[model samples]
Target: MEVFALVGPLYRRVQRKIELDTARQGLSVGLRAVLDLLREHGPMTVPQMGRAQSISRQFVQRMVNDGAANGLVEAVPNPAHARSSLIRLTDAGRAAIEAAVAREHALLREAAGDLTTADVDTCVRVLGRMLRLFEDVDVNGQAVS
Candidate 1:
């Protein structure tokens, strides 16, 4: 219960900061997430992205549509799925992502003024364990592992 209490507030605070920081770069937090996903995982269909991000396919499609309008991303032919095109970041998109990442890194550095690398590593390990525990529990209240 204490963990749940901390997690919600922590997530909101972090998300708010990211939204503000990314907005300054002319991108919303969601779009920035999509950009990061594409950069990390390569071209993917809207449904694939939706699954990865735990969002709806329509929502991901909307983001991709907006990105296409801004020339930040382009739809390429998907060999496996004829109707669903794979989205890839454009040169402009990569530049925008880079700028946003730099801004985020600066913010993170300022926020982590006193925390050492070991502290961060410990936090990462703890969080990873918590995430795995959550993943092992099914939505219907069944323990999968």
Candidate 2:
């Protein structure tokens, strides 16, 4: 329970840090997520991204729209789906994400001084388990009980 209580605050703090970092590169958090996903997983539909991030399809669509408007991403034909075009990174998008990731990595490496591999591994294991515990929750957030 103590760990659970700490999770929310920790998440908020980390998210705020990321938001500040992304802003320097002229990216909103949603756009940064969309770009990161496309870069990591290749082209995908908005629904796929929504599912991947456990967010709403409509929200992902909005982010994709913004990316398209900025020439960061473009819609290409999806052979499997007649409609829902795949969103892909433009050359500029690739460059932007790479630079952003490089900057983040540089900052992340600075945090390694005080933590051991085992400590980080334990945190990952605990967080992963906690997340999976919510997998059975309904969309309305009701527990199975």
Candidate 3:
């Protein structure tokens, strides 16, 4: 219980650092969030994607349009809706995401050079558990439905 008092803030700090670094690389946090959503869910409508990330549909649509223009995402015909299109990451988008992930991992490794692999693994596990807990809490709190 006492350990969580330290871990929570430290975990948030790490997240903030990663977000700052990603922002410096010309990827807005929202864009990264959109990319990550697409990567995990494969393809989805703007509304669906927005809901998944707790973003507004208008915002997601704008981001998807920008991504499509940049060749990072493409529009697919939606079977369920005649007018709505599904957003999917293009090959270029996947490559960019891979590059970003590699850069992030490199940064983490440099920052945690003193930590052994086992130590890093434990940190990851703890953080992952915390993330799951946060997600459940959010849902329970009506942050998502």
Candidate 4:
């Protein structure tokens, strides 16, 4: 119970760090995910990207639209869709994500400097379990993980 009590605040603090890092990089978390997904998987439709990232398709669509407007991504004709489009990272988008990832990694290493590799791995595993639990209960509950 005491550990549970500490978890919320600690999670929020970590979330805040991510929010701050995203803001400092001038990218929202959603946009960053889109860019990262594109960088890793080549090109994909917004729906495909959303599925890969576990974000809502509508939300992913909006991010792609925003990125398109900002010159980070462009709409390419998707023959399979005929209406919607596929998104691919521009050179600028790839560069932006690379920079943001480098900074985020540096921040994470600095913040977790006291922890051993095993400790970090354990933390990640715990968080993954928690997320899966939340997902399993999402339909019966009202919360975001």
Q: What would the TM-scores of all predictions be?
A: 0.87, 0.87, 0.70, 0.73
| lDDT preference between candidates 2 and 4, better one | 2
lDDT of 4 at 90: 92
TM-score of 4: 0.73
Evaluate all candidate structures by whole-model CA lDDT and list the values in order: 0.87, 0.90, 0.79, 0.81
RMSD of 4: 3.6
All predictions: root-mean-square deviation over Cα?
A: 2.8, 2.4, 3.3, 3.6
The whole-model C-alpha lDDT of candidate 3 against the native structure comes to 0.79
Tens digits of per-residue lDDT for model 1 on 5-53? 9888988998998899878878877788889899999999999998787
TM-score of predicted structure 3: 0.70
What residue pairs clash in candidate 1, if any at all? none
Model 1 C-alpha RMSD vs. true structure (Å) is 2.8
- Candidate 2 residue pairs in backbone clash: none
* CA shift of 3, model 4, Å: 5.7
Inter-residue clash pairs, candidate 3: none
**Which ten contiguous residues of candidate 4 have the minimum total lDDT?**
136-145
Question: Model 2: runs farther than 4 Å from truth?
Answer: 138-145
Give the count of colliding residue pairs in each prediction: 0, 0, 0, 0
Question: Model 2, 4-24: lDDT tens per residue?
Answer: 899889779878888999998
Question: Which candidate has the highest lDDT of all?
Answer: 2
Model 4 spans > 4 angstroms off: 1-7, 139-145
